[model samples]
Target: MVAQQHGRRGAAFAAVTMAGAVAGVVATTGCSGEVGATADDRPAGGPRVVREAADVLLASGSSKARTSMEMAAGGTRVTIRGEGGYNFAERIGRLKVVLPRDPAGASEHRPITELVAPAALYMKNRGAGVPADKWVRVDATTLEDGNLVTGGATDPLAAAELLRAARNVTFVGSQDLAGTRVWHYRGVTDIGEAAKVASPFARGALNAAAKGFAKDVVPFDAYLDDEGRLRKVRHRFSYLNQGRTVDVASTTLLYAFGSAVSVQLPPAADIFAGKIGT
Candidate 1:
């Protein structure tokens, strides 16, 4: 039963548990990589280009997205996937996230619908005794990882914004992705620095993540097209869970630029106000 006195802490903890369940499944394969030219051979303004990825996406409007969040711990690995579209200018997106099946493959879980808006995250079919039709909402800024990992799928726009603080960048060489030629770049981004330079809508959440994550430095590999649009990006993150550090590799792929995206937030009456079970 849901409790009437639910608060941010309970909601945040519940979201983390949901994410952990998705991450806890067993699987194989680690984050993929591509080898390319050395940093010295990188093109001019490599770092500057990487830092401007978020702005490029914003200018381009909306795009369809595919997301993958992979976690490995105790020699066990699992991956959660999502498909959706984002309206960058409005800072809103929607995703249908699918968790991995049981190790035995006997049963599959239902997909969860997630609505991401500025400073908030909403989910349906969250499944811990909450009604199927009721949605659970959490303040993005209150989440330790800033809802980056808590939602089981990173917000595509926020992921791009994270690159705003890229440092020590290098061109990893050119690669063809899904028939498009893209320039590959690798670098490390500081969450604190990004928070300072990120858009006003994302500043608070990034600030929270800067302090919540075990380390503010996140290593990443990003790909961009000729027009400067972000084609793909993979961010490596680590956070403390049960006193153990869990490694997560989150990948976001964007395509079909200028796509139409519609996200409708649930009304107050439809939002579950009761305490979520752990």
Candidate 2:
């Protein structure tokens, strides 16, 4: 799909879904390869380390994610920053997003909160020059209907699924991210597996990842902390956005494994049923 030019800055969604927002989390956002792997490097450890981590974290019931997506092309820049958590077992998530400002860069720090529950998607307080009033409620399967989700929407954890399905993984090195020592591994994903979790909104991101892969494998990185918990991930790819192939880099960091994450749809009275469009 062609990228939509909005306001002043380029348009981009984020990595994590807000109730139902599909974002690779590129521009205003959110890389790489390797040589002779090394003694501590595991060329095949990518899948095992990442997959096992996904299994542990997802099964742990809850997690907190901090994501960033950034893309720069055609003399424009777009970015999305979000912080929140999710409960996979409950099929629920919440995110507070700081959207890119208008072209003129005039905007307040109006962070929108997105709540995703089993039955519906709710977006609270959007639109410029508008006051806080109600949350926009949408059907679970149609997250983009109100433009609240902007582009199409998909499950944010699809990235984890992508990693779980990675192959030809190689160990990069060990580093510290946010004070946690981590072992980094890079691997390629199978398109067939990616397609399983992909939605219209995520297709471009996944396809770009595939195109960026070596041997039909788009490389993504997974970081395992000292405790063997998945702490961070980074994905790179190029997408046909707005008729141009724009580069996208996204990062998702998961923490607080097993923490309580209970996201609920706001009360019905707080839901806005009025028409909202771009």
Candidate 3:
């Protein structure tokens, strides 16, 4: 389970996954839009609606941060485990990922891969000159693919769809982050899906780790603060590969809003792109 990027985009998926999660990229829905809640939407007496802090939102532009993730998958008899790290800034980004070799079944250990980039993600194992399409758009910055909207138009949420799909959300509440109050929630996720989105690691790694993981049992925690300004998340994942079990766990923090410390959107795309790379 070496940590290398495949496909045209290499580790861009992992970069985007980390960037979006730490940035609190809230897609601006229509003012009159309605939100859909999960079965656990009602959380006893938690804060239903929390106000976004203006200063915190503004500071989210191009903030630098780091993240570490762990994952494990398997069933009944076998399991495997791995860990990943990411560093994100408006101008540059880097990721280091490592996974177990045999997990609990075999005796092979996996290798580690490091990715560094300014604009595009690098897949060291896949060779150079590969285009990271999904991670780095060439002509124009558009919303991420698979984002659902009324007119099928590209919007912020479209860019954020990558993160939203990482887990199954159940409830959304409110909490304090960076001194700002925000909305928080919890749910479940398919560890495989999230790993692919966040690390650019292979899916087979998760499958191999899970001897019989027909169902996903990963737990997810998130906080959407500042009226969609910033979000913080944590994931608890486990899997069994071969005859052993490995545990991968991690936490993520993001800031999205206000100003850019690094990237400046095109004049025409500025408003839509919001404040980024400050």
Candidate 4:
């Protein structure tokens, strides 16, 4: 299997899925007065601490996730299957992603897919292998426009901000997953119009961005263990055009960090090799 481009920002999709737990209650009430004003408004310290939590999760080991995303705007549903690993102390990581093909499109065409390993982003056009071409390379951290080559469409910057904007965290306590007790924190953020512009070819990605920006506040729910490790993240929202009652849920999970199997960015040359498939 080829390496994929699961940059730092992509990790946000996993870490902040439940960013609203802290603000979930308040978000439902609608934003009034100061947003993060209560005791919950303040961070444990600052962005660094929060970022540290993100980094720790990133550097941990072995992770597996099965996710389902429902989008009202496009009237589509997406399911994601993933497995990866991170060595925090070693700063190594790897992830694999597979997506379903468009039912309306040609059957000869393969589904859009991406693999983010220790190398560059390996995006496969599957059967479509025409015009659009193959893999490209960009910063391991951010997906600037210049980095786009082909295979799959992704925007790193927009994704990162989505995670960064999460604030007003609270210890929602702990829960057991895979036999381990994990601590949970929740928060919220309004990305404003920025989300509308950060389209990543995926409805769930776009909806997450737009909801974060338009709602002027997106809620998140996150879980971590006694060792301060992130276990799960979930995001929820109401479909605006699909009747006020229509609601949606998007979630991501992280596990087994700092383990031997953890994957990290590969050599720069391997990322932009232009290879489309295995």
TM-score leader? 1
Alpha-carbon RMSD to native, per candidate: 3.7, 7.4, 14.6, 11.3
Candidate 2 lDDT tens digits, 1-278: 11122221133332212212223452211122223436765434455667666556556688887766655633665666677888867656787767666545675446777775533456666543223777765443232111222322223455565665677777777765655556788777765466455434434444443433233345677877766667777766444434555555666777767877878767777766554433
Tell me the lDDT of model 1 at 10: 43
Error of 3 at 25 (Å): 21
Q: What does candidate 2 score on TM?
A: 0.67
**TM-score-best of 2 and 3:** 2
Candidate 3, residues 46-80: lDDT per residue as tens digits? 22221122123333444333344433223322212
- Estimate the TM-score of every prediction: 0.88, 0.67, 0.37, 0.49
- Residue by residue across 27-118, what tens digits does model 1's lDDT show? 21332345465666455688898999999999998999888888864465777888899998788999998887766677787888999886
lDDT scores of the candidates, listed in order: 0.79, 0.54, 0.31, 0.38
Error of 2 at 82 (Å): 0.6
Off by over 4 Å in 3: 1-62, 70-92, 95-163, 166-168, 191-217, 256-278
lDDT score, candidate 2, position 250: 65
Q: For candidate 3, what is the TM-score? A: 0.37
Q: How many residue pairs clash in each candidate?
A: 0, 23, 38, 41
